[model samples]
Target: MSLTEIRSRIAKACDAAGRDPGEVTLIAVSKMQPDHRVRAVLEEGQRVFGENRVQEAAGKWPGFREDFGAVELHIIGPLQTNKARQAMELAQAIHSLDRPKLATTLARLADEIGTCPDLFIQVNTGEEPQKAGILPSEVDSFVAEVRGLGLPLKGLMCIPPVDETPSLHFALLAKFADRNGLAGLSMGMSGDFEEAIALGATHVRVGSAIFGTRP
Candidate 1:
């Protein structure tokens, strides 16, 4: 699907949910995609993009920003504590703030730099052992800890177990976000974004549906 088509779907989803389409930020996930494919989307005026790694995003976006004038880069993958500074420098938002060690690292870096990117606490809604996120039980305390550090916490994020229905996870994230009065619920992806929008997803990470299959 083209960028326009994906956007249309987002708009439709918002309309069906009685939301203004403008409230949904569509993040074109360009991770592992070829440069040409990314540029094509850029040419279509897509300024917000998500990348999975700091190094790859650092390599790719500097040049794109030079050519495109301005772009919003979101680091959407699990971040190593050491990479926090680099990711902060490269992206406007970090969607995988999942652990305390990393949180402490970010808070220290934020204090030193005097600025931090928008952060979304990643919650392992499914509580999968292999996933990188705060377990369901830990979210409240984690939120307080992150807030106490004075980080720019924008909202919550989650990756539902693939075998389960996505809405259940979206709804679960919504519950947490609502409890915190978080303004950004960064859930949903290419396959289930509409359902996400319905369940109050402020940001949807759509990749293959907009950029085609990755190499």
Candidate 2:
């Protein structure tokens, strides 16, 4: 879909959910996308985006930021302990805060840097063993540990198993956030975002739909 068409659909989804369009955030996932395309989307007034690999983001982000100073970039992939400090330094938010060790590292780095961007607890709502996230049963203990680290906890994020209906996974994440007193749900992507909104997802990450197929 065209960028304009994407925004229109987002507005309609928010309306259908009885939510303020402003309350729901659209994160243009830019992994594997070139710097020029990122800048073009930013010029189109897209202010928030997400990147997957830390190395990929580190390599390409400078050019985009040089042009759009106010854009918020999120680190949305599995973060390594060695890269925690760099991620903290570069991203406006980190969406894959999935484990206690990573949280501890990020908390320490945030303290040293005097800045902690928004944090999301990634739950393996799908229980996919290969994925990077806390298991569903462990989210509460994980959040407790993160809270002790003094990092700001804003929400939950998850990518459900590819074979299942995403709404079930999105709803599970919403319930998880509610029980934990967290206020955000960064669920859904290109194929299932409207279902996500209906299920209370506050942040939906869209990539191919907005940026076209990535190289």
Candidate 3:
């Protein structure tokens, strides 16, 4: 799908949800996509993007940013503690902060560098065994801990189980954010973004629908 088509869909979703389209930020998931395809999206005026790996992003984005200076890159995958500094330097936001060690590293680095990108606490809302987010019950304490460390806690993020109803998880995340005084909810993908918008998603990460299936 083209960028225009995706934006049109987002507009329609917002309209159906009685929302202001401007309220939802669309992040093009650019992981695994070639630089040319990324440049194509850049040409289409997309400034915000989500990358899943620090290494892949490190390899691809510097030159792209040199040419497209205003791009916003978000780290949207499981972040290793050792890579926190590199992620801080490369990304404008990170969507996978799910543990204390990573949070501590980020907070320490941010204090040292005087720069911290927006942080989202990933919630394992589905309680999936292999997922890389904190359990739902752990959110409050973790949020408080990260806050005490002075990390930028912008909101929460989650990937609902593929087989279950996504709205349930999205609603859960929204409720958690509301109870915790968080305003950003990064949930939803290409398939269920409309539902997510209806439930108050501040950001939606769309990949295959825009760039086609990854190899």
Clashing pairs in 3: none
Tens digits of lDDT, candidate 2, 97-159: 988888888878887899998999999998987998999999989989998889999999999
Best by TM-score: 1
lDDT of 3 by residue, 1-215 (tens): 78899999999999999999999999999999987888999988999999999999999889998998878999999999988899999999999999998988998899899999999999999999999999999999999999899888999999999999999999999999999999999998999999999999999999989888887
Which parts of model 1 are misplaced by more than 4 Å? none
Best by lDDT: 1
TM-score, structure 3 vs. true: 0.98
Q: Candidate 2 — which pairs collide?
A: none
Q: lDDT of each model, Cα atoms only?
A: 0.95, 0.89, 0.94
Runs in model 2 lying further than 4 Å from the true structure:
none
Winner on TM-score (1 vs 3):
1
Q: Which residue pairs show collisions in model 1?
A: none
Q: What is the C-alpha RMSD of each candidate to the true structure, in Å?
A: 0.6, 1.0, 0.7
Give the poorly placed runs of model 3, Cα more than 4 Å off: none
What TM-score fits each model? 0.99, 0.97, 0.98
